[model samples]
Target chain A: MNLIGLGLVGFSALLLLLFSIAKRKSPVKLRAIPALTRLYRAFGLSVEDGTRLFIALGRESLITPNAGAPLSGLGMLRHLTERTSLSDRPPIAAAGEASLALLAQDTLEAGYQAAGAGEYYQPTTGRLTGMTPFSFAAGAMPILRDESVSASVLIGHFGVEAALLADAAERENAFLVGASDDLSSQAALYASAPEALIGEELFATSAYLGATQSHTASLTVQDILRWLIILALLAGAALKLLGMI
Target chain B: MRAIAVVLAVATGLLVLIGYFIPTLAPIQSMILNWAIILSGAAALVGVFNLIWVHWGKISRREKGSLYSAILLICLIATLIFGMLLGPDDSNMRLLVNSIIVPVEATLMALLAVTLVYASIRLLRRRANLMSVVFLATALLLLIASATLPFGEIGPLNNFVRPWFQHAWALGGARGILIGVALGTLMTGLRVLFGADRPYGGK
Candidate 1:
């Protein structure tokens, strides 16, 4: 048994529990995510402009460690699908994996069902563009260019290939808000996307965009844990300087 | 149905988590992971079929770019036939992978580098923030540091500053992001396991 992992998990569980209790007593205020805010505005603009909102669900597999970002993307998708259900052209969700595409379709259907528009839910709106990153980008570029997309929200596990899609959005003059868990992709996105989520911010979509209570509590826990980690790193540096093991 | 999915997810997740720490449960972990791999492979086939269907719809409807869709189908069928008839380990299959796939992927990667440079130039115009400036400057420094100059062997800039920045600053930032991603993954997984966040059609 790995004692460190166990301890970490235990600590996280405690923080989660405490945060949940605190959240019940008082609402938590999180720092604004500009990208998410821009995305919300883009949704409204798409409806007004009579254009489609494009959402890239990314290239991560459902069972990998990288799935976290795409799962968060799905969380945001739930909110987006609901808000844009009545639009003439609903949000177009493109994924690199079939499972994600299927889930996205289901999410759209569920959103429509919730909004009393179940009959209008079209399966083609959520599509699996390609299984590979570059192919996915290639397939999605035409949609961004031809469909008159008002905005593009890319939240997923992208590599260097993210630049291809981001560039396409720029050429089409679509508002872009992008984020990824991969550091290099995040850096690339920071340059390409007018508003980009950095590092941990990608994980906070549920709290910032969806406003889910548990997700808010989870964010609180994440913040506390980050502060703890920073302190520990600082302490370790000090100890190393002092010649202590 | 949702209840069954949630229950199954929770149970399987717990088992996997437990298997990670217990030597006795390692086999169970492997089994589950193998099942996941198989499922993913099947899903990949589904993705291929979905791609074909989408393209077929465009062709049937005589969409504006239906010609491109037809080209895609022809290439796909040709590759599939060659792959099946000759087998994956055959010389022809290897030649296709080496000649076509490798070069295309390499070209795309090369394009990515150029795109990143263009994006960096536009970063200033886009945001004009301190972070943008820092990002651009760092990128310039790294690019210059890694480049092979005509006057070889620059002392401090090449020897100390470049290595320090690459190893220290870049590595530190990457590690920080990795940690955050790891923590986020853990939290998200736990949430799913506990049925708090459902990606599978539940509230």
Candidate 2:
């Protein structure tokens, strides 16, 4: 048995439970992420202006190691859908994978239902853009162009093909906010996107989107675990420097 | 229904997770995974139908871009028919894929190279800060260093600067980001297993 792995899981679950309880007493004050804040504002502006917001959930399978980013994208979709439910043009979620498209559809439905705007929901609001990475980017370009999209969010798995979507958004003069798990995509977006969240910041979508205290609890557990990992790495490096085993 | 779904998800997740430490439960995990794969395949079909339905609405309603929708639907039907008739391994199928999909993707890649160059220039025009200049210079150096000139390769850059910047600096930052992403993924996964956050339509 991998005892260390089991230990880490147990520790994380314990921290999660503890924080979930603590959250009811007082709200957790999270460090602000400016890019995410701007993304929220842009979506709000799209609603106010009677323009659509397009969320491009990249073509990553739910079963893959890269599923986290796209799942996070879905979480954000739910929140955004609720926020934009009463708008003339509801937000559109375009995903690359078939299963993800289905989930996106479900999330949108749930969001609208929660907001008491279920009658305004349309299945077409959640789209399956394409099956492949480049094709997905190609398929999504038209939606960004033709849908009266005032703003777009690319918060999924993308590689160099992100440049194409960015270019499309650029041409359309839409506000672009992108975040991805892949470094290549992140770097490209850093150059093109006005607001781009790098690395693990992609996972902060739900916490920043007015999600439940459970989301905040998870963020706290993640922060604590991050510090622990950093300390372990530092200790290991120091031991190596001292010629210790 | 929500409670049942959450219980099933948590139970299945626990079983699969426990299967890791208990060899006896491995088969149960495998069986559940097989079911998941089948569900995903079925979901893909639903997705294709959704695509067709959306485009059909656009075409029927004569939306502004309905022409594109018609073309897409025609192409999609043709591809599906050809693939179904001859199967994926047939030479004609290979020809169809190679002739259409491959070239389209390659063209996209070519466009991406141009787009990156354009974006780099625009980055300079927009940001123009100290970090932006350094970013632009570093990207240029790396691109030039990796290329072969008329005379020969840039030996000093390929040998020294490129390696140092990539391995010493970029790699460190990348590793740090990766560790953070890993932690975040773990937390997200745990949230689902714990039913803290449900992306499957649960409120």
The model with the greatest DockQ is: 2
User: Model 1, residue A75: what's the lDDT?
Assistant: 81
lDDT of 2 at B12: 89
Candidate 1 off by > 4 Å: none
Model 1 C-alpha lDDT per residue in residues B4-28, reported as the tens digit of each score? 9889888887788777777798899
Worst 10 residues of 2 chain B by lDDT: B14-23
Residue-wise lDDT of candidate 2 within A174-244, one digit each (tens)?
99889999989998998988778888889988899875777888888888898898899999999999999
- DockQ, 0 to 1 scale, candidate 2: 0.76
B81-153 per-residue lDDT for model 2 (tens digits):
9889999999999998999899999999998889988899999786678988988999999989999888898
For each candidate, what is the lDDT?
0.84, 0.88
* C-alpha TM-score for every candidate: 0.95, 0.97
lDDT of 1 by residue, A1-245 (tens): 38788678778877777777678878678887777887788889898878999999998887786888888888888888888888998888999888888888888887877778889888788888877888888888878987779898898899878888999999998998888998878888888778888888888887876676678888877878888999999999999999997
Give the runs in model 2 whose Cα sits over 4 Å from its true position.
Answer: none
